[model samples]
Target: MPVTDCYTCDREAEFDQLPPRERIGHDSLWRVSHATGSELLGWLVLVPRRHVMEVADLTDEEAAALGRWQVRLARVFAQELGTPKTYIIELGEAPGFHLHFHVVPRPVDLDPELRGPKIFGYLGRPEPAESPARDALATRLGAALDRLNE
Candidate 1:
């Protein structure tokens, strides 16, 4: 996607204006946010601050910090939300979607039927904006991220 039409870039523009649920945390290279239009909590997304569509396009500094952010989010999810593990994926396939990684919290009791890639079902079918549960989780996750990063 062109920079002008990129969804992730638009969201970055709305940085301070975004709702609490939309802005979780960020470092210099990557921004963490709750996935929009999803019914899940702790369904965090990690996107580069700059507009680059593929992993190969990442600068050396961006590549270096990428894995650390992934692991930190996973650890925060486990500590705060009882997530047993996290599912990290980067398809970079959707048009205008920008390059981002999904760091999904797989709870200990997740149904056997939704294991592995099947868990992607939790995405897309999202609750409305200002969803109380998702927003609340965002608050908790935000705080947890602070502690974890500290």
Candidate 2:
């Protein structure tokens, strides 16, 4: 379906303007990175450059490229974060009517009770202390993406 006036479209310029530390990677049509203030490991988000509400609305090229990017990111997360599995998620209740995917890395040691719902469970909760460990992980993942592009 055709799109108009969606927040993602309106804010396309702002995506590039996001600081370097927040950026994980970007192809022609999508931008990917870790979500700000996430409490878990390797919590990534992939957002389309254009505004679209649903995955089915993606153009054929976008559909193909999106899968490729997501898979590549999953590999990077696993390799860099020591995650055993990666969960690709799409929860669309937000101001940005743009299609996006979440690449959540699942570490083997995660508490079973906190594994699923609690991964992103603290989304709106008060921010946690600055974790040097998470910062290091992000640096490694960002460096990994840079190497992949080489």
lDDT of 2 by residue, 100-145 (tens): 7888888888888767757777455554635565566667887887
User: What TM-score does candidate 2 get on C-alpha atoms?
Assistant: 0.78
Best by lDDT: 1
RMSD of 2: 3.4
Q: What's the lDDT of the predicted structure labeled candidate 2? A: 0.72
Per-candidate TM-score against the hidden true structure: 0.90, 0.78
| lDDT for position 129 in model 1 | 48
**Which 10-residue window in model 1 sums to the lowest lDDT?**
126-135
**Tens-digit lDDT track of model 1 for 112-150:** 988899888777784654567767878888888898857
Clashing pairs in 1: 37-126, 38-126
Sequence-dependent TM-score of model 1 = 0.90
lDDT agreement with native, every candidate = 0.83, 0.72
Displacement of the residue 112 alpha carbon in candidate 1, Å: 0.8
